[model samples]
Target: MFDVKTIGIIHTPYQQKFGVPRQPNLVPLGTGELHLIAPFNHPDCVRGLEQFSHLWLLFMFNHTAHQGWQNMVRPPRLGGNEKMGIFATRSTFRPNPIGLSAVELHDIVIQDNCTILKLGSVDLVDKTPIIDIKPYLPYSDSYPLAKASYASEKPAIMLTILFSELADQQLLLKPQLKDLIQQVIAQDPRPAYKKKSLSTQEFGITLQNANIRFKVEDDIATILSVE
Candidate 1:
């Protein structure tokens, strides 16, 4: 049997999974904490970890259950309509239910009270269990001359942030807010391919005790209100 053990816990701002962004790096300043567990907490484990600016995480889809396996899946990118081979897309529902995310390691502070790794650009839900961590080695990891397939294609639209004066001040101080919103919206959080005869319109997405309503006009997104 192939046994897997969780070595750490990830504390993120995302409490729900309904509208999570596709990639972590897209998050502007999305912040979180990486709490390492004991045994892995031995000082030796942390050695040479500080040299890298980012790390790759392999984790489990604890919230989801396996229902055998499907050779094909309906992806949100296709407006939840078209079916594609599961290997062609990165849907959370899978045979193995494994999840991988790349996150920025801002700092690893070993406090007497607790040892933690402050992080950025996390697209994980709160209290996600992390299976393992590996530093990003540019030599083996980077591919300057790589094809991104369908992913390389940009979305037909873009996300814009228009914050109220109160939110503006808050964003300036904690820029992570802007990044967080972008990460959430950029994935075209709307229902995949819902046809409404409109390319530009206004909508809202909830986050951290705030309701963000935005409008898309002139191909530019305008933050309409925050209530």
Candidate 2:
């Protein structure tokens, strides 16, 4: 049997998965930190890691564990109208409930007796277990001619957002939080099957200790409140 150990845990503003951006770096304003566990928190462990601007994070989908996977998955980018082989899509329900994300390495610091690595544009859930961290090599990782069948082009923002008075007040208290919300909503986090449907249902997303409610209508998303 193979043994895998978690070397760290990720801390982020995202308290749940309902509103998480589907891909890493998609929400450039979102940020997080990786707190290294004992034995792995030593400075020597990351001696030359600071030279790289980005890193690859291998993490576990702890919440999705025990759910079986299928050979085919419906991709959200395809509007859930088509099926692709499991290997072609980044589906959390996999043979192994693990995820890989490329995130910007902002800095390494110590606070409150803990060593942490500050990350930017991270698409992981709060408290996600990190299995490994590796420097990202742009020379080999990037392909100028790489082609995707249906996802070749970046998705465009299709909706306009309006914040309620309560949300505006919350933004004044925490201005940095506004960018995260704007970018996430612009991407439209609804499921592929519900993208074209319309309803009066209010959707709520939790960020840090604040809750945000909004509704979508005719390609417009209006923030109802922030509490």
Candidate 3:
């Protein structure tokens, strides 16, 4: 058996999986920080990391790992109706329960002797356990001519977001979160089945310490409140 160790934990605005972007860099406003732990927190561990503009994060699916896995899964990209081989999709349910994401590396900071890597356009949930980190080499990683069957293109921003008076007022206290909130909601965080039909059901997601509630009707997502 192979042994793995968590070098750090990533803190992102997504407190829950319900609203996290399905893929990295989908929401450019989404930002996070990786706080290295123990021996890994030393500056020598990341001596030349700052030279790279992006990095690849190898993280564990801590929340879903306990649920076990199956060989087949329904991919949200296929409207959650078609079953595909687990290896064929990016399902969190897997034998290894591992996930990989390429995120923009904004900066590396040392605060109170703790090493932290500031990241942008991340898709990881809050407090995600990171197993490993590697610099992203665009020359070898980028393949513009590559084709993805179902996810050939980036998902479209399906909904128009409108904030309520209360939400607008709350934004005054945290103006920095306004752009993040709009970008997240614009991608339409509803389930695949819900996206196939129009419903008046209200939805809520926890971003940072705020509880954002909203509803979708006729392709318009109205922010009901921010508590």
Candidate 4:
């Protein structure tokens, strides 16, 4: 048997799984702080981390706990296309319940023995337990000719933003709303195989409890209504 321990807790904006991006890179602007807990705070443990542009975060799915793991999981990209083994997918439910993500490292200021991991491109849920960290060596991580068996090719995509004509007189230019909308749409919510018909259809994501619905027309996505 192998023994394991949590290095620290990762802090994220999401308290629940309802709206978080499926992966970290998908939320390129999300902010997070890795609250380095005691014991793992030993400076030697995090030595030389500042030299890397990005680091691989190894964390645990403390919220998505599973008992007697399943062998297959349906990836959202496939829109329930086919079943693949747990090992082949980054599903939260697996025999080990571990996760890995390459996140941009914004800063690494050390306080006493603790290292404050300031980061960008984070999409983890609040208080997620971290197991380990490793530098992402570009020489080995990037492969220009690599093949993606599931979703390799990038497709032509477009989006729009139209605010409600009835928007609050004093809230028409709220920065948070724009930030939220940009964050939500950049994720490309539509299923991979689905046709790009959002040009005239309405769709939305929950923002600050309001359903920020909109319709994409031509190249402009109009925020038809907010409720």
* lDDT of candidate 2 over 57-103, digit per residue (tens): 99999878788799999998888989999899998889999899999
Kindly give the number of clashing pairs for every candidate. 3, 0, 0, 4
TM-score for each model = 0.77, 0.94, 0.96, 0.74
Please report, as a residue range, the 10-residue window in candidate 4 with the lowest summed lDDT: 153-162
Which candidate achieves the best TM-score against the true structure? Answer: 3
Over the stretch 1-227, how does candidate 3's per-residue lDDT look in tens digits? 78899999999999999889999888887899999998899999999999999999999999899999998999988889999999999999999889999999999998788999999889989999999999999999999999888999999887899999989998987877887888999988898888877668789999887899998999899888888
The root-mean-square deviation over C-alpha atoms between each candidate and the true structure, in angstroms, is 3.7, 1.5, 1.3, 4.4
lDDT of 4 by residue, 1-227 (tens): 88878888887755555546776666555667887778877777778888888988999887787554788987766666788888877777888788888789888768766777888767677788999888999999999899887867642233554566764432466666566656656555555443345445656655545666666556565666655
- Candidate 2 has its poorest 10 consecutive residues by lDDT at 193-202
Residue-level lDDT of model 1, residues 14-86, one tens digit each, is 6666555666765555577988889887767878899999899888887764555589987765667778899
Tell me model 2's lDDT, rounded to 2 decimals.
0.86
- For candidate 1, what is the TM-score? 0.77
Better of 3 and 4 by TM-score: 3
Q: Pick the candidate with the highest lDDT.
A: 3
Superior by lDDT: candidate 1 or candidate 2: 2
